[model samples]
Target chain A: MMTIKEIRKRLDGGDISCRELTEAFLDAAKRDNPALNAYIRITEEEALRAADAADARRAKGEALSPLDGVPFILKDNINTKGITTTCASKMLANYVPIFDAFIWEKLRDSGAIMLGKGNMDEFAMGSTGETSYFGATSNPHNLDHVAGGSSSGPAAAVAGGLAVFGIGSDTGGSVRIPASFCGLVGLKPTYGAISRRGVIAYGSSLDQIGPIAVCAEDAALVFDAMCEKDPGDMTSVGSEPVTPKLTGSVAGKKIGMAREFFEVMSPPVREAIERAVKLFEKMGATIVPLEFPMLRYTLSTYYIIACAEAASNLGRFDGLRYGYRAESAADLDDFICRTRTEGFGKEVRRRILLGTYVLSAGYYDAYYNKAQLLRRAIKNEFSEMFKKCDLLLGPTVATTALQKGSGLTPVEMYQTDICTSSVNLAGLPAMSVPCGFDEKGLPIGLQLVGPHFGESEILSAALAFERETAGEFLKSSGMGVKL
Target chain B: MISLDELKKLANLAKLSLEGEDVDALAADITSILEFANTVSEAVVDLPKDEAAGAYNLREDVVAPSYPAEEILLNAAEKLDTYFVARKIGGTGA
Candidate 1:
């Protein structure tokens, strides 16, 4: 129950050994993982070895960084050399990468321990984690409810006290929604802010690896370790250099609450975010008002554009290489067709079909190009709104944690991502922090979104809010984990 | 609404096979999805190209040692030594 700051302080002060800290998390994971199903593979041996190395470094006064001994979870989609990166899909059920993801390499160099890869929706496809081949991750708040995904297990693992922090790729609400559901802090950095070199692609344009932690400060620390310009990634951009100068004060800052974000949220979610707005005002943050009609275009724009990109990105999985292959095939064509047909789940196939249709010659102008234009408009809409305010505030998800077997149809399911997807569409920095819990005792997350490359402003606002409210929430709810 | 033939065609293009109940389900799903996608048409306009396309990085063209051939092929489904055994095209190399 220690924050990364306290843990590092203790480790530095020789009060706790890295091996001892890792073993404590390992024991807790072992006790809780059976029912929660938080991790796909518990790399105990590797984690212990890394912890011992960290201990040795500390012993020699040669620790690599402040996060040297921290244990963190990765969404299964990110590659780890010699570790199977299944992406929680049958398609890549046995696929192990020969190289580490850029983020993983960065963290590894920092001496952070890898707890294991956390389960996700297949190919990061679903709003709920139920689409995972390994199985749905249970929300830490309630056993029968879902850990909102596609970063379900990562969120669950962090919330369930299984890891110090987690790394998840947010395409359309993957990291943020789960963080909301689990009552954690999840940051989806500006697109290209974090390198995507070895992440299994879902939407090449929208996918960015971000941090999920118990609070904003920890998220910022983990993000600092991982955010770097990778020559390997063409889209990777240089660091914005925010950490050293994080003035966690939002006094006199203009915090905008979009009318569109409030219009459709459930009552409890609205109340929590409204309460958060009042708190921001109390903290001397100015409240600005704005309405956006273009916000309505996001769900469709994100689906079309993401699917289109996914269609092309996933074309490499044609059964000739690593991953699940059909046993029965008469020819090369049949082999590919059957391999994909059998390997992919229903939702993944549905997306592939939709993506193909959008990019098809006949429908290209109508679907793909139109979505791009709408994407531009949405970006422009935000650009204009930022002129009136410093950051945007809203609900991360329309509702709290969904029931595990809600059996909501796909269209119904898509609505779960309504509040968060537009941020991904515009490639902006957004954070979801625990605001309060609802009537069912499930957590409610308050979202703070900043303008492009404005992570500092948003994180500062979020940090101020957390510092004000953390003690009360921690005392009452005990951090949203059932155990 | 997408027809069964259209679904099949899309599946073929995606290198996937649709059989049993998937065809009907996908058709219905695509229909609803297309209905949602239709919303974009209203906002579509021929706008000029963006003035600031953001800073893009161009790496120098340099030859670097890559993952070894054996290591790279470690996950290939059908492989013989370092060579991947792929489907024969053009009948014995013409």
Candidate 2:
């Protein structure tokens, strides 16, 4: 699979037409999607049409953005005008958006071709892709193992060379986890850095649409394009362009190694993270050992807040507006109840119930309010730590991709997001870059977390690591379009 | 552990029916999740002053051209004359 730069060079040199490139990706998706299940819907017609437009623009010598003519995958949750945005759930399985999402509009303007909607966990609720109503996305590295969720399909599609890069949303570890599992680069930008308008909300405060790519520079390119303020989403503050500042320099940088994150990692993950730290040290980065006791409370806080928001956000899915409607209901109330009960998957129902439990009158103070307070404490800890270090270095996840049908309980599954959730809670920028592989040969991701709106710093560090490793740990699955 | 009755009530509050499903297993799952969430109660820290209170990015109050009713209602399961169609209040089977 070629990087965006290489693809751009070829397109510029007239080595390949945009239509041909798009066809290559579409053909790859056709060939590999049966085994990978990465895409919920392939927009073949739209892709070719867009490719022709790109070719016409190039022919007319119109200015082209870096992503112009780039074929990519959009996560199913992000709305595309007249295209189905299912959130990988039965509830919205047939629901097509009348308007485009904010990020999609940006990408569309940049002449990015949409290959399809990537599969994800149903309503972006689960850590593993298994909860998706479409089907679990298989790990490209090893087909038996699961692709991490809820951005499983996007990561898998990118790793399998189905698309140049994929746009995915990260609530907890959705983007980064799968990228880590698939040996790709995933970035969850600082909260509110990108507009969430038309993004089906899960954990509204925690969710940020990010890029899943093969390298840090590619992630930076996509992030730069999408990070912008929008009137539709008031929380969106936009961001500085990190792509220009990716100097790939770690000299004199202070990288904090939080002991708490290290203590929870599996042996292989720990060794990989330790090796990454050593490499950064060799690159002239100062390692700052730190104690972040607040790490233990993050998972509970994240789930409580995320689920509470999810419950509220999903209330709009009543039978009247759109999506699945239950048949043979006695009344309005019954209609809604039956529709939701039948439409939502088991995991989504569980989260909704949990959220309702926490926000209920009597339990509000005990659960929701307590979680909010803990959220503040966690955010404050991250804020303080940022003062001591340029970035926080740790494992993206505690373990590698688990085999399909691992059948871990719900709570156990939620525990896997421990390493990635805190970044969302604190509304910080973070990226998961492939560092090494486990004994099973699954990829291990080293996380670089930065202060609020500190995308440039973290991305710079990630690029430096990517440059040093020179794609050593970033092995290909040898499945998709190889340009 | 959450009782079956409590689980049913919570499910009702969430607008979901617990019919024909494994209520016992769901109850166990929710109970364990609640137990996991209970760990937050042990966190000892002064509640940091809420810095984000009233930090909303309020756009100028202007009437913008909204999506046409036909377009907005394009995805509606049932619609009539630009309005979403729903079951009448307190009405029985259609």
Candidate 3:
């Protein structure tokens, strides 16, 4: 599980070949994916060929970028040209896009080898990996427990050493929750920091492609490779020229703590994040306790807005052009009806129906419009809070990884994302770095939230935290994280 | 509580179908979620007059090489020559 930086150094020093590294990771994926269900498809032929091409380029002293020869996994939701991008749903079970996502094109230019597409919650809609049509991704640390979703397999693959890092989408807590459960570093960069052109839309306004790696420094390396604007995505704001000063010193840095996030938090989880906050304080940082009244309603605001957008964005999948088509229908209406009803899973259908109800006449203002205004107020509150502090700290999730069959209702599962979703609502950057292990030996994560486009600042602070802790709890808890 | 009839209407709007007790179950689910979402109506806020941040980042109306028409039609279940084949919207040829 060498860092991408370490691997690059080795590649430069002639200690390893890109083809050899790709083969090794391919071997790991073969060994682990069957047990963990991490990868939906492993592109062995293309990846090894690309690896050889990379090696040849390096032999000619023409390395493309610093990330050249690095191997990583992509969440299945991202289009990879010829490879199938299923989004782990039956509807898209056969989808193979003709083009690559903006980030995929960027990573390709960097000469980063793709191992495979990681399994995820269907349509990136659920909290646990069980929602995947391919099957649930198991936590590498505990076989019986579930990996968090919708970026479940990406997190598990990184934590299981199947790839050097994983690229995943975080719409809501999809990326962070899995990273928290798997004890990996996952970043949800500021909205529009990375272009989202070829990503299969879930909640378009909230979705952003990001990196999940072993640590914040590794995540930072991948983040740099992905921060480019594309003409394809008009919303993508070109990454600001803010050189991340990784001072590793947080002296006098103001870290805000919103108590409402901890109100319903389990004791072990609360203790774990508070422990991280204390470590920051010990490093000469100042803790600024605060309250966000608007945040209490964010979970509701998220579902309303996210669902409304999903209902509209998903209308494109009616079996006319591509994706799953019903066997036979009397008319186009019946065709659309059968295609959607048969192709979608229970959760997807439920969301579509709820979204339809909210956006319907007479209910639009009461639900969708109100949610939008409340989202603005929440964003404004976060902006005002940033004026008082450099970063905000809290638990990544309210609890540790639940067992695979927790049987929680949809709202109950939605509650698990309460601490993480508000960041998405405000379009701010946030990272979930493993802080400590809960009593059950499950890992807990500390979520560090930053202002809009403050990726470098948050990464710098996260690096400081990772350096200070250095997985001290792993030794105490007897849980071996693949790193 | 949302009735099953309303659930059917929502499903119709979404272009999906819900039948039998599933509709009843969905009604309960949507109702409970709406109960939670409805609280946002109570939130106080002054709406902004001008919501747009600034000018749109409009790209030039340039015609680049698109996805080859053949490639685009490759996945269609039914196609008539270069066009995708579908049933007529309002008629079933009945």
Candidate 4:
């Protein structure tokens, strides 16, 4: 149950060797992963070797990054050399990357031990972990409920204490939503803050790799490690670090809570938001009511844009090219039909069709173009609102995690993403901090979004709130049970 | 009006193949999705023509390190020493 920082201290102090800690995490992962379904692969053999090297370095009195010797899991979508970065799709299930993702190299250079690959929705399309080809990731808090996805396995792994923290790509709350449901701190940094090189792209414009961890403080640490100018990804900001420059106080921060968001949330979720707002007010922050009427259409716009991008990005997965191909075929079309039929899951197929339809000739202006127009409107609405407030606040999801097989239709399932997608569309930084639990004992996350490149302020406010509340999700009883 | 054949065509463009029933299902699904999409015209006003009208521009052509031909071809399912081999679904006279 040791926090990441505490584990680091023990490693630095020689009270416990790095090898011992890695072994401990590996053991925990072996035991927990079965119940949680958090991992798609575990690198126990490699982790042990890395831990031994780290210990040797520390014994020589060499200085290392704070993350040294810490075991962390990565979402399967991010490439790791020699490891299969399947992106939870059967087509690429055995596709081991020959080169490491840029961030992977950075973390490796920092002396972090690789735990394994966490599961994710196929191509990061679904909001619920249910879309993963590997099988759904169960919420650690409630086994009968889903871990919010496509970062489901990452969040569940972190919450289950199978790994210190996990890296997940957030496109439309893929990271934050799971973090909220699993009661972890999920930070979707401002666009381009982290490099996307070697990470499988879902939506080239919207996908961002972020951290899901036990607390906001730990997320900041991970962010600092991965925050660098990666020449590999042109979109990466050049050698700029903003967290260290964050000096503002949340005490006097003017926070805006969207009335529109409140109208959509469940009663318990609304109450939790109210309670969190009051707590922030007590912590010297002021809450203001704001209107963002265009958010009602965020899901529509997000689906069109994200699916369109996905359709294009995933086109490279033809069987004869680089993915799993049928053993025998009558012809090339037969090969494609059989391979795709067996390779892709239901949700991936659904989205691919949806995306193709939107981007098809003649229909593009009606669907994709219209969605972009609405995206601009949503962005403009938030831009104007940001003029009056330092940050915007709302429940991360409209309701608590739904029960498994609750039979939510396509639209109902899409609605779960409503509260989180607007920030992604606006290209702003946001974090989901644990607020409270529902009567069913599931976690609720209160998301704080700031203007573009405002992660430092967002983190500062979230960290301050977490400190004031002194409530850690893992501290609650029944938290680590099957979800 | 969209039809199942058109849905199948869209799927083929996306490199996906659907059964006739799936095509029908997807066509129905897309029809509803497009119906909701039709509402966007009413939802947004004063759409910026310039913003919606532009696409990302690439930088000037420049030489940069690239994967060796062998390495690039290594990821292909079928590869020759100098090229990747795939069944020619459609390419010019193929």
Superior candidate under lDDT, 3 versus 4: 3
lDDT per residue, candidate 2, A77-176, as tens digits?
9998888889999999999889889999999998889999999999988877999999899999999999999999999999999999999899998999
Predicted candidate 1 versus true structure: per-residue lDDT over A1-483, tens digit per residue: 457887799899998899888888888788888778879889999999999999999999999986899888999999999999999989898998999999999999999999889989999999889999999998877879898899998999888888889999999999999999988889999998999999999998899999898877888888889878898888898465566657778899998878988888999989998888899999999999998888888998999998898888888887776888887666778777888888888888888888999999999988887788788788888999999999999999989999988988788898898889999988999989889888998999988899877888888998899887754443222332221
The per-residue C-alpha lDDT of model 3 at residue A463 equals 80
Candidate that beats the other on lDDT, 1 or 4, i.e. the better one:
1
Per-residue lDDT over A273-306 for candidate 4, one digit per residue giving the tens place of the 0 to 100 score? 9998998898888888899999878888988888
Ranking by DockQ: 2, 3, 1, 4
> How far in Å is the alpha carbon of A314 misplaced in model 3?
0.2
Model 4: which docking level applies? acceptable
Error of 2 at A387 (Å): 1.4
Q: Tell me the spans in candidate 3 whose CA falls farther than 4 Å from its real position.
A: A241-244, A473-483, B53-56, B62-65, B90-94
lDDT of each: 0.86, 0.91, 0.85, 0.82
DockQ of each: 0.51, 0.75, 0.64, 0.41
Cα deviation of B39, candidate 1, in Å: 1.5
Q: Give me the candidate number with maximum TM-score.
A: 2
Off by over 4 Å in 4: A242-249, A472-483, B20-24, B52-60, B88-94
What TM-score would you report for chain A in candidate 2? Answer: 0.99
Clash pairs detected, candidate 1: none
Q: Using TM-score as the measure, what is the rank order of every candidate, best first?
A: 2, 1, 3, 4
**How big is the positional error of residue B3 in model 2, measured in Å on the Cα after superposition?**
1.6
> Worst 10-residue stretch by lDDT in candidate 2 chain A?
A59-68
